[model samples]
Target: MPVTDYQGSTSSPFSFGRSLLSLRRDTTAIMPSGEEADLEAFQRHVASTLAELLPAADAGAGDEFLSAAWIRRLLEAFVLCQEEFRVVVAQARRRAGAQLPVAAERMVAEFHERAVKALDVCNAARDGVDQVRRWERLADIAASALGAPGEVHEGQLRRARKALTDLSTLLVDDAAAASGAGGVASFLSSHRNRSFGRARASPSRTAVAGAAASASASHFRSLSWSVSRTWSAARQLQAIGAGLAAPRAHEAGLAAPVYSMGCVLHLTAWALVAAVPCPDRGNALQAHHLPAAPPRAAFPWAPPLLALQERLAEEGKRKDRRHSCGLLKEIHSLEKSTQKLAEAIDAAPIPLFGDRENDVREAAAELAAVCESMRDGLEPLERLVREVFHRIVRSRVDGLDSSMHNAD
Candidate 1:
């Protein structure tokens, strides 16, 4: 059976595969140990290669999307190479961060530069720049990544590049209209799907994995440590990569290019780490912000963590709203407010932050002093929020009081 000939029927096995891909069942998951090792190595190679390309971007555009999005995609074969790089780097940071001294902390700046170049070229090409001045700089970066093994994003870039070439050669009226994402989506969708039937579970199981890991550290310190370290880097890379991957302005919100909360948290945490007066002193470590995660402690005072276990029992109760006359719009009104803030982030150029970062630095510094002086005033507030949110979640999911066993 020449698999391609299943052209028109719902009963086609090909169609069935398409359906599976959409469900996203851990198809790529749980691969054999050997395969996992190979995959990890392949990813590492990509991360390092991408790093080479950053210098070029840093040289050209410090804080901008480079050119526009459309033009570069048009020129680069529509490969959207940078997006893959983003994903790859994010993963690399987590795995490699533990190993690298300062690289993990500083990689974001490099990513900002690389994204600017790739995105610039993509936008320029899409907007009808018939023959762009040969960007010798981009070519240099692209050249280095051409045959590199660590070039994980290379595959992504190649596909996008092919699309760009095809669009230019064919003079496609609407490159997007012709984008065969649906077919590919269907194919992948059919081959692997997990959400076909609702996973009778909350995503928080995965979302709160960090919290849970921190909570049960004694029994699973090794597993928790590995997951936490890996996720921190992977998640950051994912954010930056995904932000620039999408066509500019298409879904700017999703591909948010500017400094995000994640970036803030990351830098803040690191600054706090560097600000640590002395590691040997238990008192200062206790006074630090976000509390250095509890991997080593038998019982860590991790807020998000404590919140999760507390959720085993607590349930949040929504407050009553009597001003039902559209007054409730205020809660969601923040949507627009969020957009402006996001735009402010994107519009601002790289070294995307200067004073705000300093502000955060100052804030982190004061946290220890403030915590020492403030003591338990807000601690009860913190505990209350933790207990309530958890109770609400547990009761909603389990339909019974999680704290029933612990009742007085």
Candidate 2:
């Protein structure tokens, strides 16, 4: 089905109803007129939107808009929202018992299970990316130390290097091809106006319906901004990966090192795919009843993680030739940082609307802030990792060249 351009008049390949707002408002009269009604309406809108946005065939086929990371995220979020709504509906039906039809009960259960399965699939794909990233980093370390004077056994290093290189190459080729032909620029242009409401800190629920309506509209817009920023990082990684995969001068025995870098890029691409979520199909009841965000806790984990990272870094700085140690320290720091960020995410609340009366919005804003901070921290780590790998590769190549000239 053609998607309606949020900005331009250009028709999408598949047709969905005019705009999300119009479709949602049109059905408001036919549906019950409260929080539950809004949620049902939102869920229907999301399902219909997904039906339109998602490819009619295989997800891997690479339809221009459907293939985008943001689109995937939007779909995932919609599925989650629907799942949550179904749970509520089931619970309410159980309370009403004899009043609700058996068929209605069965249908609700089925929808909930389907949503769960979809979420699991999305999560598994995300985990695959994370696993590949860890391996890629390991490969970088091994490749960088190829010709360096180290106590590590040559045989073990060579074996590890070969394994990492091969795996990296395979993963990169697959991801690059699977990503399809659509560029980020084209995707952004097509869906520019699909923003959702800005979540804010609020303390009441009396006006939640009005707030939810506005929030439903703005949430995607905010998400689009977040996704676009993340895409920039993904693009950088892809470019680097492409360079690593390219043939270079004196490259005969150095495929492992180059492929190691490529692995990082491929892993990054997969991570981007994992991070995408669908549109926000939230309602007042779900927003009010959902679990509260994590409580503000002491920084127990941060201190220890930071201490270890600092200790490793100090040890590396004290020695002149501990480049490997320095790299290890950097890796440790990144790991610690990642852990801290994850904890923050687990504890942070997600806001559902921008209204001051809605506490959900406040929680959501806090979560967004933490995420922004995490992104800031990751930028430096990414740069450090890239520089370390480049330095190691360059030094190794220089060493190999010098040896050849001496032999001549």
Candidate 3:
């Protein structure tokens, strides 16, 4: 936890352990097998060894002896971390298949995930932290876990690590379909399966459509950006990338001109599109999957849905729930982006669809036929719209926060 030089009262006895965390935290210093020394002297020798083992030149070695001690100490810590990570990653791989003991499986899985994550945090913590080759070797080790014979384990550890590596890649893929529609939270929570090794180059397949889902935020900037609501004031959020940043270049369709609660409604609508059942081509529209959710209580719409219930006063129409609580991807295991648009046949705003009542029936019929053939053909368009809305929502929040924080 604390970085220190091998000096003074900080030196502790050297000991070795198998746990990744414990190994990383090891502070004891032991001289080479040829000799042993007191804590300070041992620590000095460790520091010296670490410098030599690491690529750095043995610099600042005033008397040379203390330097070897310091470098060695550092190297010991590094080696410990590497070993710990290897074990954990191996365990995670072991979880691919077969009914291993519950405890072992859980322990292994967690170690794999966290080891990968910790490596990332550490790798980025400082410049010259470690060589890229070191990570590559870890990657190979993780991948080998996949060779465990069955489809399950084949390399789950390798898979997890690779996923983590992909996560470290550049922010967003603008040329993607859902390209500008999600954020860090959205990606981590919703797109895990589609991310890592499955990336595609165009919007022709599900993979392409999925990746495109997070592109550009240009649409949001076109919307009136400012002010924040008291209710949404405390949530700390990260900056959205291209896919979630969906901005417009001063020119785009329906450019989110108004700043009413319209953006929320629009986002909600997008969620509906993502949730409902749509027609399928190559099963893109029909292949049912789980919901992209805010989780149980983390459900963002609980408050609004509760209010919707109260506002209904008496019993309302059907039991149509907005399956996509915060975004479209969280729809029922049966929805597609295009289906939402078709489903929007019932979307409100009386005048927008012509004779209002008549248009619903017409649009419904047309949507059915269109979905029957095109399926997700319209998904890219929907993703773009969602991107715009995401930006709009984010900007409004940011503008408000900026003012609030700067108020005093």
Q: Local distance difference test, per candidate?
A: 0.25, 0.31, 0.27
lDDT tens readout by residue for model 1, 1-408: 112322333221112112333222322242233433433433333233223222243543321111122112111211122222233333433454323224333334444443332221122211211111111112222223222333224243332222222212221111112121221122222212121112342566433433332343223212121112222222232333343221234422112222222222222222221111111111211222222232212211123333322321121111211111011122112112222222232233323246543432333233223223223222332222222223223222221221232131
What lDDT does candidate 2 reach at residue 267? Answer: 30
Which residue segments of model 2 deviate by more than 4 Å? 1-40, 43-72, 87-99, 113-127, 142-164, 168-408
Error of 2 at 74 (Å): 3.3
Q: Which candidate is the best by TM-score?
A: 2
> How far out, in Å, is residue 84 in model 2?
5.4
User: How close is every model to the real structure, measured as TM-score?
Assistant: 0.17, 0.25, 0.17
Q: Provide the lowest-lDDT 10-residue window in model 3.
A: 233-242
Clashing residue pair totals per candidate (backbone < 3 A): 64, 32, 63
**Candidate 2 residue lDDT tens string, 1-408:** 011112332222322235434443555463445545544444354334434443244544223221223233333333233233433343344445523344443333332232222222233233333333443343333333332333334343333323333322322322233332122212222222211111332335314533443453243223222122223322333333332233234532222222322222233222333222111101100112112221113111223222322332343233321211112222223223322322322233332113321332233233334334334433333332223223223333433453354345
Candidate 2 has its poorest 10 consecutive residues by lDDT at 277-286
Higher-ranked by lDDT: 2 or 3 = 2
Q: lDDT tens string, model 3, 143-211? A: 333323433231353243333333222112210221122333233334333433343323354454344
